[model samples]
Target: MNIAIMGAGLSGLACAITLEKAGIRPAIFEKRSQVGDRFVNGEALLSIFTHPDRDNIATFSDQYGIYLSPTSHIQRMELFSKNKKAVIEGHLGFSNIRGREQDSFEAQLERQTKSTIKFHSEETYEQLLSDYTHVVLAAGDGAYSKSMKNFREDFTVSIKGVTISGKFDRYTVMSWLDYDLAPFGYGFLIPYSEKEANLSIAIPDIPKNAHVHISDLWDVFYQKVRSQLVQNLPITDQFQITQYPIGICNSPRIGNTYFVGNCYGSMMPFMGFGQYAAILSGVYAAYDLCGMGNYEELMKPLRQSYENSLVLRKAMEQLSNEGLDRIIHSLQGDWADKLFQSHRINPLKIASYLLRPYIKLKNE
Candidate 1:
């Protein structure tokens, strides 16, 4: 089968690799000259593989033989405000190879596959469609897909993020989330080393009726947060400043063409773990479309995960809009923050949340 994948990010590339493994030829169409350049420069951070590779990220690394360093052992997880509280169960997700400079994961995938990825590439969805038997819209949602009538919605208060990697005296990701610094959003002091950490803050756009970009938020939020929290931490290593529009989509885009990864719907309202969802979605789309397995059976997990994410995300967004102040205050004291974090960040919970989703999908 001749397959053309649009957008050479994780989802597209992974799909190509899977097809190749199945003895199919797939061509990648990328808008950027270099693979992962956008994602790399964008400061993407994902979960360390606690799940299996069927849709797990660790499987992707192993499949391609990409070596990733563990940034932290996840020593502690505690939320703080006026009072410091220890989160009961959910562990801290470590910063993975995506944040590291040495090996950009996208490039490695491209090189390993010998998959034809015409870089610095550009063409319309129609132009691409004419060229291949199958055109997988690997570009995550936002771009209009001919297969789908509408685009996914951006959920969070769009934010600009500045991530810096340097030696920090602080040990945990929670160490940096002080009111002085990361109000509106949070801070992650991901332990790259006992001494080094990836200090990141999500600077949110001004709410409701405000005109603000990420840079403005970064300036205001950083100054505020840093003044209260890490006043003494050296800003010596200001590595990169990148902005990503984050939020859950109203729904995942599914049609004749498959939209995976950021294109399908980022599925990241908190700590960007869209790659996991993206991977799983890619696997399902590939297997189903390629006619390799039971259509419903192969896609059960994938559909469940996506639908589960959508349902919870919609609920949370409604909750946020309806009573955000009260919710934030509650999170300040109780498990509200933990719940908020988990609803989006925790895949295990997400999977469990999908129990009914799978059943409903099977019914439909």
Candidate 2:
């Protein structure tokens, strides 16, 4: 009874670790020689796992024994429009340590398990399926399974960032909303420490050539900096730009192979946060392989959240600057807290959200 997992990324490593813990030895194959090698040149960032629920990163790490260190803790988030700004307080931290050193998150996970990965094994899904009893497609972003039926181009984003040295609030992360700047996207600053942070913006290329290039996103960011949207976030001359396509996968299981991470379309639609989903998908795949539970059922909340976020994003795109301001203002109270804590959204919340503008209009 041999099992094989493709890709040595967080998703693949996570699946391997889970299976290994269950006393199941799964062969791990990666095209790259080492973990995090593919993302070395770019400025990569992922949210710190601090959800205020059973689904938080810490709880998952403890349960699975995967150690993740937080570079910065964002307990406060400020939202902005051209004429409106709102501050919401809660857990919104992130980890920038991925692929930083030779031995980082993925590397540490590999080392802790004392497992060996078959590097340079660029085997395709068809090849693997013929080889192992069960296969897990934990491939990272853009690697789709053959069973992925609806692999549509949801959005393409140009992400450019700089590591600036200045006095920054380590506890706070900020986002700006302007249809002109991001179109259907947004800009943000995630500070890893008080002295430095990764400042970047995601501009969606929705209408094909609509949003255009990374320099345009930078121009918008410069304007925001001059306007002091996030107080004093000084930008050094040092920076790099990278772009990637992100989308979702409809089915968790495709044939005899189970999909995880970006390969399965686990990436969230709104903010491009997929690390949590990626890790959880790996865990769920392992459990399903062991007959503990169905991967689709275990991942229902995450899938639902992805769908809910898509609805919210579409609604946001329809809002005017003033409407965006009103929405940001509404997000400051208890609703904001609840919104970030839960991974999934229910029908009642969706209904209330749809009627929110009318309620506000009636109140006015």
Candidate 3:
């Protein structure tokens, strides 16, 4: 079967690697000159986000044959609200570099694939669909899926971020839930190393946040970070994204074409964590192509996670500063420990079910 995979990001590369193992070498296409060809930043693979799987990297290697090395194992996470702060420590997850770096996740995945990636090619989906028997749409976003009338767009987000040179705890990640800084969104600091980190804020595109200036919010967030870290972190590079779609495809497979990665809605709407799901989607798509499994059936859990996260996102958007403060305060001590370390209970699913009624009431 002739196959063509779009975008050499996590999902595409993972698909290629898995297909190669099945004795099929798919044609890979990447718009960028090379893998990881974008702004360098830090992203976390939180264990809590991927319930039932405590360690993401280990599971990828053991189950999917995808070996990845994280920059640091996240041992601590600091959560800050408008009026309160909470710290959760333990085996939280992992932190990895994204984009352009030799050690980035994309670079690691690219090294595993034997298929040649046609870099700097502007090949359109319509053109590829006609030639290849099967096409995997892992274009790193939902644009093509939306164009194909398969995307279910829930919301859009504006994000601004920068790489800063400062003293940092590589194993500790920080996040803020102050509306004054990010409106219905949030801010985060993920460290790439002991001396470098990515500081960013994301604001959702809603009517209440329509008047929210990203630059203004960024300024406030920057000052807050400075005060919290007690350091004048010097920015070395910056990136800004507007109207970035965060949603899922209506179907994992439509006809002979398959959607994976962000195109498949691996990105959760709650806090934007989906690296593991994205990679898995690509592998699952490859499996379906090889007649090993059904893509739709394999994606059920990921889709459910997306729906659960959306419920949390809606509830968060309706919360006031005081409410956020209370939530943060509640997460302190034993509550935070149990929430992050629990394996028997899927916190996200439980929380979503509990919050559904409140969300319904608020909407009415």
What lDDT score belongs to each candidate, Candidate 1 first? Answer: 0.51, 0.67, 0.92
Q: Which pairs of residues collide in candidate 2?
A: 48-94, 74-93, 249-265
- The TM-score measured for candidate 2 stands at 0.82
Give the per-residue lDDT digits (tens) of candidate 1, residues 101-122.
4455565566656678887777
| Weakest ten-residue segment in model 1 by summed lDDT | 48-57
Instruction: Rank all candidate structures by their TM-score, best first, as comma-separated numbers.
Output: 3, 2, 1
TM-score of every model versus the real structure: 0.68, 0.82, 0.98
Q: Which residues of candidate 3, in runs, are more than 4 Å off?
A: 360-364
TM-score of 1: 0.68
Per-residue error (Å), model 3, residue 313: 0.4
Best candidate (score: TM-score): 3
* Per-residue accuracy of model 3 over 191-292 as CA lDDT, tens digit each: 999999999999899899878878888887998899888999999999999999998898999999999999889889999888989999999999999999
Task: Please identify model 1 stretches exceeding 4 Å from their true place.
Answer: 39-73, 87-93, 146-148, 154-156, 169-171, 175-184, 191-197, 203-217, 224-256, 294-364
For candidate 2, lDDT tens digit of each residue in 197-256? Answer: 667677655564363776866876766664684455566634444456566666778667
lDDT-better candidate, 1 vs 3: 3
Instruction: Please list the Cα RMSD from the true structure of every candidate, rounded to 1 decimal place.
Output: 6.5, 5.4, 1.6
Q: For model 3, name the residue pairs that clash.
A: 36-100
